[model samples]
Target: MAMSLWNPTKRNSVVLGLLSPRAMLTRWPSQWIGGALADSFEACVDVQRTALRDAGPAAFDVLIGSSWGGAVAAALIAEGAWTGPAVMLCPALSELRRHGAIEAIVDQIAALPAERKAQCLIVHGDADETIP
Candidate 1:
């Protein structure tokens, strides 16, 4: 379930996220894609780590995320790190910059077909501009 358009949580499920930048990333105020991307990526990892630690003896049995978090989820997937089913919606992995990253790995994320990628639930809105 998407907690917000940007953040969502899957209770009792292990999740890794790649969060999107705030709308300001799209605005002219501070259009630094690198920082936003890095920050979001790092924050996501931190959250996952915390969750894993909190799991203590046992944490997540599945992973879930949306938007920018999808990218984070993909990064973990690519690294062959983490375990559990994954879910991504309206992911931003394809486009690194929301005025954030200089580039995106959307193709990389999408490249992994259903057979190759982790068992997951992915959703995309027809009206989204992040699509390439």
Candidate 2:
């Protein structure tokens, strides 16, 4: 969900910013299977690889993810779908339990392949009630 990599030129930045948020509506699936969220994380990475295969490799300066998006980004990187420096801010690993969802995202990430994980940047506000 943290896809700011469309185009960074001044001419295109505006359109890119606007399109990015709009794409969020299109990005997430309408319905995700409830119990299989964990198993599907890697599957998503596979899909990403397939989608990007024909597109060719592109420059990725860094990845910045917030809330649920951050968790997803971590999973994507851990599954080898993305290769770049990452920044996770106010990540929503607790949302799964908060909303009566499935297992915790943090736990899932802890189980990812060691090769896919790398040093990352995380920033969370202490006052934020999300992550205690």
Q: Which candidate leads the pack in lDDT? A: 1
Q: Would you list the C-alpha lDDT of every candidate in the order shown? A: 0.55, 0.52
User: What is the per-residue lDDT of model 2 for residues 55-117, given as tens digits with 9 covering 90 to 100?
Assistant: 555745676768755666665555556666778887655653443343444566677666545
Superposed Cα deviation of residue 128, candidate 2 (Å): 0.4
* Model 1 agreement with the true structure over 49-77: per-residue lDDT tens digits: 56656666256676666776676676665
What is the RMSD, in Å, between candidate 1 and the native fold over all Cα?
8.1
Off by over 4 Å in 1: 1-31, 53-58, 97-118, 130-132
Provide the global lDDT of candidate 2 against the true structure.
0.52
Best-fitting candidate, scored by TM-score: 1
TM-score of each: 0.53, 0.48
Model 2 C-alpha RMSD vs. true structure (Å) is 9.5
